[model samples]
Target: MTARRADRAGRALAQGLALALALAVVSPACAAEADPANDYPTEARADYVFACMAANGQTREALHKCACSQDVLATILPYDKYVEAETVLSMRQGVGLTANVFRNAARFDDVVADLRRAQAEAEIRCF
Candidate 1:
């Protein structure tokens, strides 16, 4: 490799190291914000919904808002147990809401009931 290229790489590394050190020293005040896990009520809720929706493979466009709404619902109900109780697969992207999965309404209702019950439990627990 060219000496100039090596020297430039070394300088970049050094600059990165210096920036890291500076951040460590100057970021305490920023880090002083309450920890979500222990200090904030909504943080854990948001985290839970985000994780659950991600696991269920909700659409990216809906994830943030869906997670937030789920978090609020979870406060009224426990989402964790609900998500745990059923098999949640990814919702098909671009599929209309009226798209039918099963031919039988009874069977589809059963599946929906299972999912809703899970959500209901989560809401109650979150509350």
Candidate 2:
């Protein structure tokens, strides 16, 4: 179970990174001037929230969403890789992911890193 959880966590992190990169590349169809990834900060927040959810055992959907044969933890790592892993799992709206995932020092750091990267991508490509 530990191994499986670690594998799942690794997968979730990769998907989050991929999602970040993809979101960065693909501008929204509706807006030409506005950056899709930063239009509302939802993606960054969602990234953190979903990761928190996965870590806290709130949901396992991210396991399915982030399926990969190879371990992808390093490729998708932020400071709070574990918390981000948890956050990326449960992701829901009208609730909170930052609050759920930010119970640790490392987790909070990872959120900041992830948010910064996402924000940068939004500015460089989307904007």
Cα lDDT, all candidates: 0.54, 0.48
Cα TM-score per model: 0.27, 0.23
| Candidate 2 Cα errors over 4 Å, as ranges | 28-30, 33-127
RMSD of each: 12.4, 20.3
Ten-residue region with minimum lDDT total, candidate 2 = 66-75
lDDT of 2 at 112: 57
On TM-score, the leading prediction is 1
What TM-score does model 2 achieve against the real structure?
0.23
lDDT of 2: 0.48
Model 1: lDDT of residue 80: 47
